[model samples]
Structures are given as structure tokens and as C-alpha cells.
Target: MGTVYQINKGLNRPISFKGLKAQYIAYLSAGLVVLLLGFTVGYILGLPLVVLLPATGLLGGGLFVGVNFLSKRFGRYGLMKYLASRRVPVYLWFNSRKLFTQLKIGEGYGKK
Candidate 1:
């Protein structure tokens, strides 16, 4: 889960993410290891040309997907709010408790 934020109406929303921090860090670390292996193999095999480009491209593509997934999952709250705001029924859930309590309190005060 990503950070939770309260909207202006005081309702909490949760953010989701694809990979956790540690897993992401570990994935990058493994990519670095693969990159180093690619470089070393190229150096030892004297094939200076062919392998490096493909290796880098593969590693880069993996990182791109990982980052994109993370952002989309974690950044969804604004979208959720937009969806909720567009529907009156959705917004009412957030306000119903407060509205009911206020009404009850007003009725009691008036009775006194």
C-alpha cells in the first residue's frame, strides 16, 4: 500500500502499489549484477559489439515496466476521487454520518 490521504470531506483513501520498496530495490540490484555480467562477458569474449546493446535494452525495459506499474498503482487516489465526485451516491457515503449526527444534535438542542 502507498500513503493514505484524507480528502477535503474527511474520508480516507488507500493507495496500492505493485512492488514493495525492498523488492524494487532488489530488482534494481539484480539488474546491476546482470549489467556487470554482460559487460564482463563482452570484455572476456572479445565480442565488444553484439551483446552489450541487447543486455542493456533488456534491463532497461524491465525497469521501465516496474516503475510504471508502481506509479499507476500508487497514484490512483486522485483518480478515485474524481470518480467518486462524479457520482452523487458515492459522495453521500462520506457525508452521511456527519449529516445524521448534526441533525440529531440540532434536534436535541431545540428540544431543550
Candidate 2:
């Protein structure tokens, strides 16, 4: 017999965009799209090219660089891990399974 195989083997393929590996492609593409949309919307809104060009350039550049830096500093899984680590907690509780230790519809956690 050969090596064991997973049932969801298709999911194991590395995520990529264009020829670039990992999330770089996604970041670049999204940045470019934002750049284009910024210009288009600015033009339609009658903003001057002088201001629009620089503003869009900075916006797009910042997004592109930010994304690239994030991806590089944190590998595929690391990026999500980084984000999760910084997220605020939704559930806060002590030891007891008292009256308000569960999730509520519109009320704050641990509060009535």
C-alpha cells in the first residue's frame, strides 16, 4: 500500500495569486483595485488631479506596503495568529457558572 491520503486533499494546495506565492498576490491586487477605484471616484467627484494623484498614491502605497510587510513578518498562519492575539475578548468570566456567565443577545457579557 502507498502512503495514507486525506479525504479533503484538495484543500492542501498552497494558496497563491497570479505567479506570486502566499498572500502577497491578494494584497497587491487589492491595493491596485483600491488605487483604481480611488482615481475613478475622485474623477467623477470633480476632484483636482493634483490632489487626487498624490492622495491615491499614498493610500495605495500604504496599503500595499502594509500588507506586504504583514505577510512577510508573519507567515500564512502567523498573520491570522497575530490578528487573533490582538483582538478584544468577547467572553469574560470567573469560575462560577452563575446567572450571567453565558452569551446574551443584546447585553454585555457577565452582565445582566
Q: Estimate each model's TM-score.
A: 0.35, 0.55
Candidate 2 TM-score over all chains jointly: 0.55
lDDT (Cα, tens digit) per residue for candidate 1, span 1-112: 8999865653463322344332444555676787778777887788755767787778778876775565455453444565567786744557447667667555857586
| Whole-structure CA lDDT of model 1 | 0.61
RMSD after Cα superposition, model 1:
14.0
Candidate 1 wrongly placed segments (more than 4 Å): 1-20, 67-112
Residue 6 error for model 2, in Å? 27
**lDDT, candidates in the order shown:** 0.61, 0.74
Backbone clash total, candidate 1: 0
Model 2, 68-97: lDDT tens per residue? 677667766787777776684757534567
Number of clashes in every candidate structure? 0, 0
